[model samples]
Target: MATRAELTEIFGAEGVISLPRSEATAAGLSEDDARVLCDVGFPAELPVIFSLDVPGDPSAFSLVPVDTGADITKVLCLGGPSGNSEMRYCLDMEDGYVILLTLGRQPAAEIINSTVDAFVEFLYRYGLRLKHIASADDRQADEYTKQLRQYLAERDPQAFAEEDTWWNMIFDRLLGKEF
Candidate 1:
């Protein structure tokens, strides 16, 4: 998993948001999962994909048990791509896998990552490349994006296992420069 220092280098300290261990656990994440989140923190928004919505205080903290009959991490993406629909990115309470759930359609839940660690690594690598891509020419941007995709595939094959997987969809969106 990427360390907080590395994430800070990519996203800046303010851009990374994380809850304390007690809050994360109260929010339904496993101790291992909570450790990664609390230790490294995650990006506020990975544009064209999802945004983080971790509560700032204990009073506002509560784990959402989605329509799938599965509990989800509170540090989740609550809305759709545009922050409007019922789509959400949640870490399954039973398993540490990150799931992309479309409420009311439980069958459509797509596994976003095999594990929270993989998810964090993806976020870190993606954010780092985005920084590099921002200053590059179009050719360099394409090459960097391609390289990032390759890295993700090699790092977490399960995430790219299906054609309709979130990571695959995200690559298409990256081409459109949505992030």
Candidate 2:
């Protein structure tokens, strides 16, 4: 569950902003999808590692929309870097899966989590782990990274189902920079 208090704690009170139901509906979102966006809303502007930014509008659903093979509206782009080939975070309304539309001509959209709640939780968890990483030893850092990866996989196996997922890319970058 992505309760208000939990989100506030993760992305300060000022940072959190609920997605508008009207915008979601206008974007061809389902009732359940609209409800989820309105209820567990995300930060309209997040510049963190697990980031999804909609600076122009408040949690706007209007951006570079993509067709994820299935249908023209299967993947709904929330926000990210501009352009069609840029990194865009999206939502698979019907499946309730959060997508990290990566850059490349290949399969651009990859599942970030099975649900938006898990995605929020992952962002919170990753941030916490990053804050405390400096205090940990080399061995501790490796263990913590492994634990976080395992936790994320357990939370949503579909997100980590592929070897070259967005989650894997994040972990790889983390290793390259930190460990």
Highest lDDT among the candidates is held by which one? 1
Instruction: Tell me the spans in candidate 1 whose CA falls farther than 4 Å from its real position.
Output: 53-61, 67-82, 104-107, 176-179
Worst 10 residues of 1 by lDDT: 53-62
Instruction: Give Cα-based local distance difference scores for all models.
Output: 0.70, 0.66
Q: Which segments of model 2 are wrong by more than 4 Å? A: 44-48, 54-60, 63-65, 68-70, 81-85, 102-107, 177-179
lDDT of 1 by residue, 64-156 (tens): 554555533333442234352556666676767777766554436788888877887888888788788888998899889988898889989
Model 1 clash pairs are none
In each prediction, how many residue pairs overlap at the backbone (N, C-alpha, C within less than 3 A)?
Answer: 0, 0
- What are the root-mean-square deviations of the candidates from the true structure over C-alphas? 4.4, 4.1
Best candidate, TM-score-wise? 1
Q: Residue-wise lDDT of candidate 2 within 1-179, one digit each (tens)?
A: 55667667766787666677777777777776676667776654444453355334323365444665665655666565333335667777768787776655664666778877777667667765765676998778878998988988898787778777778877777666432
lDDT for model 1 comes to 0.70
